[model samples]
Target chain A: MSKSVRKKPAAPKKPVAPRKPAAGKKPVAAKKAAAVKAAGMAKQPDIAPLLTVSDIHTYYGDSHVLQGVSLDVKPGECVALLGRNGAGKTTTLRSIVSLTPVRRGHVGFDGLDITHSPTHRIIREGIGYVPEDRGIFSSLSVREHLDIALWAAKKPPERRDEVLKIFPRISERLEHFGQQLSGGEQQMLSIARALLAEPRLLILDEPSEGLAPIIVDEVRDTLARVKKTGTSILLVEQNVAMALALADRVVVLSQGMVQFTGTPAELEAQPDVKDTYLGIA
Target chain B: MTFFLFNLLNGLQLSMLIFLMAIGLTVIFGLMDILNLAHGAFYMAGAYFGYVVFQATGSFWIALAIAPLLPLVLGFLLQYFVLQPLIDRGRSAHLDMALLTFGLLFFTIGLIDLVFFETLGLTFMSIDKPAGLGSYVNIGTFYPSYRLFIIAVGLLVALIVWLLLERTVVGAVVRAGVDDREMVRAMGVNVYVVFASVFALGCGLAGLAGVIAGAELSINITMGVQILIPTLVVVVLGGLGSVKGCFFGSLIVGMTETLSQAYVPALALFATYLILAAMLVFRPQGFFGRTPKSV
Candidate 1:
């Protein structure tokens, strides 16, 4: 070994894949993790699955969307929901939060059925939703947004400091109105506001839709960091590379049905699935 | 000069009474976005209910306590059976709902008119003067103590309302909901409950204002439209849903109306319309109201 090996200032980027496990279903996840290790990565933590949505039907007035969507997210794991445009992915997220009127089936989060509960009640039951459009009050400043969020949720006052740590950008833009921020800044504030709610599960719909690649990478990194802090995530993303790299498990929805659910290795191996669905062949 | 002081006191009392009436109207309009022309009917109901109570038990105090409750209960039932459905189905239009409430107003007013004649009925009813202060006081000139009390109470209520809106979370949500109902509802708040509660509260305030007016002045069927127009002006002038704005607007309207009647005899004929015209020319959205944001 060299006497003075130059140490990098930041953590090294480890390879994201391992080895293909034994053929014919020896726990799809184990094989996937093995593939991740074979590609040169340490063993990640095994988190419990926190949410299980099954055959959920949602509609918007007369529009029949979210036909029979089903997915699960393990506790402290980042689960990415990928789909094509108008594949009812956003409707699935909204239905889970009880913002959209549900027609049938169940959404179980933290071992409680919340398919029929009101949005505010769902919020109180510990699920934070960052909507696709980023619903921030244009007139409210960053500080005021946090103040109103906590007050409305009847949450304790001290989470404000904890929120600032994750979103130092919001702390910096404390006096800026929601409308005053750039697109990337508003996205950061929206995610930060949701995190301040201190939910066990955070459902973010299309967080990387319009941001620059660098900003998208920052969001991807933040999700990874927050997952480490024990907040499980249900992420919906259009960026295939970001989804595959960051998610512990990937669930693909096509026309409101789960088309494929597996780890990134299986998805990478299935070239046909990638080519047909995402145009990524 | 003594006559001027008397008129000033009279004006203050009238403003305070109108403030009570307009608070309910503005709250329902601003928060719920429901046009309720029948709000004036609540005032009429209070006057009639107070008269009935005053007749039943020769006690003005009991009438004061019981009179407002009847109209409040009536408002709740009306909302539940009538207005709520209209608002829920997205059928709320200014002219349509205005006509609906106006019909209810006429029906209620006519019912009372039939029962108690066109003239002020129940001759035994008289407000007991606040003792010690008597009817008049000389503060350099002369003032009515009862009218002064009424003005004090009105200002106190307005201050309390301002505190509720500025300091409390529920009030903050109400104000936000007023500007943007969909935004508030999308944030997981049940704006329907907020609307119902605010409607009841506004109508309740109107009823109480009616009882006070009935005691202070004469109660008649014709009082509804005549008083309603001025109160609407006050609400608009103060900026809808802004208590501070309403307070200052009320004082301005009150002082102008009072002074014009006393000092300028010829001007009194066109005084209310004159103020309305000037305000329209200067500030169409009222003095304190901000320009509404595009949805």
Candidate 2:
């Protein structure tokens, strides 16, 4: 039933490589040797991506928004996904969390295939998402918002105090309704709420989208503190400088595919790619 | 003066009954965006359940205790089997759900009619007021003690509902859900379960109202349909989702209904409609309704 909803095409057949005479005959021993090699590969820091999205195709109704898009976030590292408007950056983050489910390809999280897992399951498996619009409940107070997330994550009550220490402005406006807060305060509350879940990976969509420059600096400082805690982050942002400043590596998306993936310095060296893909000179 | 006082008391009692009916309607509509036309069927089922329990147990208290449970269970079943599937089809399925529930309403009414009136040969059913509530109490004119008890129960239930929404974690989730369902789900809560539980709660309240109304007015198969229009008016007048609005809307409706019926018998039925039309013209969002924010 689930498969019917996905509309998957036939699985691609692997191309056979020229091999030694012993390779195809002794299948069991070959599988064992390959398993050993894979395990050995996992020990390498670059090989074991914490969150790997490989060639995921996603859609919004009939509109094919993300066409075979893929990226990776390594353990305890921050990777910013940068793109122009409608470049599928937000859809990439959404697909990882299965909010907009992938029609093809796999999403491996913490060494498990979670490509078809439900949104809540993805969240429970320690991925916190902060949506672009903030998604705050107008009727809920700041305290209630954090408390609900903590309750969902089954965190201790003291987690609230710890989160407050990180975002003191939220603490100051704890009793105020979510709609009452300014854009920066709401963003802080959103990030703080996601942090309380104690997720291994936090996915933030446009956290500095509409905030003032000073507020963006506060958010940057907060992200730096969060990075020090060793939680992997997948950030989707349009602010080129902010993305470059915080990201250890950057993935630039264009027309629903990965245009470039490298260190910020590597991206900085190529102004033509930036201008052509990101509309940045 | 005595006549005016009598009408006022009568209106107040009617208002409490309307509140019980409207409270559930507003919550279910608010949280799920489902316009359940079959809500009145639950009310009718409650009255019938109360009748059966009262007949078999020979106790009003026992009947009252068990009547609402039946509707709660029925609500869960309906939510799981019927409403859940429609909801999964997305926002466009709202009209389809309303039509489905409308069909459910008629089915329930038909089933009850066949079982009670056709099979059992009982034309109409009514439960006696509980022992202590049977007598009359004087407030310038004689009023039934059961009516006063209902008013008290209504106020108490309102307070309890208010507290539940304001002070509990479940209430916070519910309120958050009313504002943003996707956000609640992203927070790792199964919003479907929350929606089902809330739908059941609303259904139970409707049932309780039915059981109470059974004793006040005679229970007939057509009673659900008869009261559904007025109840919907109360819900809209109270601003669709606001409990406080339901309370005051019920009062205004009840008063208009009773006073207009008492003085100008010909316009009695139209009085509530007149007020509703006036509200639509002057304050389209209703008294307490805020304009919904686009997501």
* DockQ, each predicted model: 0.18, 0.44
Among the numbered candidates, top lDDT falls to: 2
**Candidate 2, A22-133: lDDT as tens digits:** 2332221111111212221232324356677777889899999998776677667788888899999989988888878788877887666788877788898789999999
Could you give candidate 1's per-residue lDDT for residues A1-281 as a string of tens digits?
A: 10111222334333223222225522212111212122211223333236767677887777778877767776666788887898888888888887676798777765566777767777766677777877666655667667667775666878888878887887899888767987788788778877777777888988887899999989888888877777878888898888777786677777777666666666776777677666788
Stretches of candidate 2 off by over 4 Å are A1-47
Which 10 residues in a row give candidate 2 chain B its minimum summed lDDT? Answer: B286-295
Q: After superposition, how far is residue B152 of candidate 1 from its true place, in Å?
A: 1.7
Query: Cα deviation in Å at residue B284, candidate 1?
Result: 6.3
What does the lDDT read for residue B29 in candidate 2?
Answer: 82
Q: What share of the true interface contacts does each candidate keep?
A: 0.17, 0.58
Q: Please give the interface root mean square deviation for model 2, in Å.
A: 1.9
Q: Model 1 misses residue B253 by how many Å?
A: 4.7
- TM-scores, all models, native as reference: 0.74, 0.90
Per residue, candidate 2 scores C-alpha lDDT tens digits across B1-295 of 8899888888888888888878888878877788888999999989999999999998988988999999988998888777876676564366887898999999999999899999999977899999889999888889889989888878888888888888888888887877777788788877777788888888888899889999989999888887788888987887866778888998998889989999999999788998999988998877887654413
B-chain TM-score, every candidate?
Answer: 0.90, 0.96
Give fnat for candidate 2.
0.58
